[model samples]
Structure formats: C-alpha cells, structure tokens
Target: METSAYLNAVVEQTNTLAGWVHGRDATAPVPTCPKWTLADLVDHVGATQRMVAMLVGERMTEPDSAYARYVPAPGDPAQWRDWLTGTAAEAEQAFASVTDDTPVWDPSGAAAGVPFWSRRLFGEACVHRADAAAALGLPYELAPELAVAAIEDWLDTLTSRGYWENRPDFADAMRGSGQTLHFHATDASGEWLARREPDRVVLERTHTKADITVRGPAADLLLVLSRRRPLSATPTLELHGDRTLIDRWIEHMDWVTGD
Candidate 1:
C-alpha cells in the first residue's frame, strides 16, 4: 500500500475508535487487551500517534528522551474522544510534511522512513480499534482492502528477523521442517502462503497447498491472525488442514498479548 493510503486508513480507524468510546465508560475493561480499560486504549492510540508524528515530522534518526518519558493521559471518557482525534490530526499534519522516502528512526532498522511509520501506525490503530469495539460490545467492520493491508504488514513483520531478535527461543519454536500455513480471504482476492524454514518464516502472496489453510473474510482473518479472537471460537473461518499447526502459530504469535 502507498503511504497516503495507510495514512488515510489511520485517520478512518482513529475516527472509528473515537466514536466507539464517545460518551462511554472510560473504565470499561477491554476483553481483547485484557489489561487495559477503555481510557487506557484511547490514550495508547493517541500516544502512538504522537510518537510517530515526532519521529516522521522531526525526521529523527534515533529515539529521543521525549519519546521515552512520555505518558498517557488519564482515563476521562468525557474528553478522550476529543484528545484522540486531536492527536490523530497532529499525526496527519506531521506525516503530511514529509515524503514517504524521508528518513526516520526505526527500532528494528529493517525498514526506515515515513512509509514504515505510516504502515506501523496504521496497524497499531487498526488492531486497537478492533479491541475498542470488542470492549464496547459493538460490531466491528473494516474495508477489505484495509484488512488485506493489515494482514500483509503483519506477515511482513513475521518474516523480519529483527522482530524475533529478543525472542530467539520463540523463533526457534516457530521454525519447522517445511511445514506451511495458508491464509485465504474469502471476501477479497487476498491469499498468502507461509512456510516455516530452519532460519526464518517465509511468506508469499499465492494460493497453494499447505499443512493448514484459514479461509475467511479479510477482517475476520485479521482478527484471528492478530490474536484478538481465537480460531476455534470464530465461526467465520474454515479450517482445511492441520489444526495443530494453526494452533501452534497462535501459541507463539504474541503481538497483541505483549507476551
């Protein structure tokens, strides 16, 4: 996806997140996040926007003290929507000041520039927006293209060695002797094949045989892949192969749970 597309999706998802919590209880527990209240989630979204804004707008090549010491606002539902929207607008303006190729600090160093930040922030907001919705007991929906982009970005992260640098044991657990998993989006023309290699997990955009294949709407697939929902509980997806392989992937994939 282009940088602009990602930025636009961030705006839309941020708005949706704000709407979910508008006039609602800030203290509401987010079942998906497990540890955060509604207000914590909102503050997280705003802080992330600010962090990326500072990174891209200032064109910093490294983390600054400000990024490290910043804190989230208190849980105040009456004001959280406005605060969240304001921060998103701040991020949008900051992103607008630079080209996609503009240099910026990336902790992983696997990807750099505004494009990376754009995609990163988009994923952060998109996944957390779903968390907010699930918390509020409201139905969630995302455009197929947006969901596809989210899935692709996540797969890209999995394929990056930098992501697993701190968790070598988990990385070793993920590697296998040519085991493969397929993800097929029934609502859109998106498909992916992920194969476990001794050194890393390789992902390709294609349709083929696999040890396990998850077929579903793009949004549902995003939720399951991101660990927001359990594959066994989600009725939208169809399992066509080794269920244990998918379960193992979910057991090791801990992006959302902070494990």
Candidate 2:
C-alpha cells in the first residue's frame, strides 16, 4: 500500500477506537487486555502513538520524557479521550508528511524510514482497534495488504535487535535449526518464511511448504502470529511436518525488540 493509504488506515482505525472509547461505559473492563478498562486501553494506545510520533519526528535515539508528559491519571475519562484523539492526530500528521524511504532509527532494527513507522503505527492501531472491538463484542476487520505487511514487520523485529535483549530464551530457541516456518494468507496471496540460523532468524517472502503452514485470512494470520489472538481461533492452519515445531516456535517467539 502507498504510504498515505497506510497513514489513512492508521488514522481511521485510531478514530474508530476513539469513537468506541467515547461511547463505551467508562467502568467496563476490556476483555482482551484483562487488566484494563476501556479508558485504560485508550490511554495505552494513545500513549504509544505519541511515543512513536516523538521518536520519528525528533529522531530520538533514547527514550524521552516528552512522550509521557501528557499521560492521563486514573479515572480521568475526559483527559483520556482527549489524549487518544489529540495524539492520534499528531501522529497522523507526522506520518503523512514523510516519504517511505526517509531514514529514522527504529528500535526494532527493521528497515529504517518513514515506511517503518507507517507500517508500525498502522499495525499497532489496527490491532488495538481489534482489542477494543473484541472488548465490546464488535466485529474486527483489517485491510489484507496492511495485515500482511504488519506480520512481516513484526517478525523482522522479533528476530532482530528487538528480541535479542528482551527474549533471550526465544532467541536461543530460534537459533541453529536451519528449519523454517511459513505463513500463507489464503485471501491475499501473501507468504512469509522464517529460517532458523545460528546467528539470527532470517525472514523472507516465499511460498514453499516448510515445517508448518499457517493458513488464514491475512488479518487473522497476523493476529495469531502477533499473539493478539489464540491459535485455536485459526483452525484453517495446516500443520505440515512437525506441529511441535510450530508450537515451540509460537511459544518461544517474542515480538517486541530492544529491551
């Protein structure tokens, strides 16, 4: 998808989530996030969006206190909503002005640039939108291309600098096997293969059957791979060679990079 389209999707989803928060009972708990109320969910996502916007806009190399300057206090419904909508607008505008290839530091160590933030923000907003929707028993939907790209970005981050420090166990598990796990999106013609190596997990776009084959809609597959949704939700997934390998892969995988 074009950079603007990705930004549009992020903005649309963020607005949808903001609308949900505005309409929801402030005291209600979020089902997917368990410990959070609707207000808290809004706060978390809004805070993250603000953080990313600062990181990219300021070319930040370290965490900044500016991102936390507007954090909402508990039970502050009006402030929470304001933060969500306000920060989302700031992020949307920051993302809209950049070209895909403009360089920036992504702690995830994926491809650096406006495209990285574009894809990351879109995926983050969309997934949290799903979280909010699930909390309200509403249906969730995502663009197929956006879903596929999100999965790719996440996997790249997980196997690179991002995962190494936070999830050593997972990183160790993925090493030296030379084995591969393939994800095929039945609806979008999207395919990804992750190959295990002594040094790092090497990911690429491919279609050949590997040790396991996860099959689903692009969005569903992305959610499952991201651990936002359970694997049982995707019965369409075909386990080719070793189901245990796939199970272990998911169990040990860590998505966030950089401690």
lDDT of 2: 0.72
Which regions of candidate 1 fall more than 4 Å away from where they truly are?
Answer: none
Please give, for residues 136-250, the per-residue lDDT of candidate 2 as tens digits.
8878888787787777767766766666656778777878668888888877868888888887888888888687777778888877786667787777555567777777777
**lDDT by residue (tens digit), candidate 1, 1-259:** 8887888888888988887788798788888877888777887889889888888888888878548856686566777778788878888899889997777877554756688788888988889988988888888888888898888887777667676676686688888889999999988789999899887888899999999999999999999998898887899899998999999998777765533
- Residue runs of model 2 more than 4 Å from their true location after superposition: 65-70, 78-82, 100-103, 253-259
Maximum-TM-score candidate: 1
TM-score of every model versus the real structure: 0.93, 0.85
What is the number of residue pairs that collide in model 1?
0
TM-score of model 2 vs. true structure: 0.85
Candidate 2 residue pairs that clash: 162-257, 162-258, 176-197
Error of 1 at 44 (Å): 1.3
Model 1 TM-score is 0.93
Cα lDDT, all candidates:
0.83, 0.72
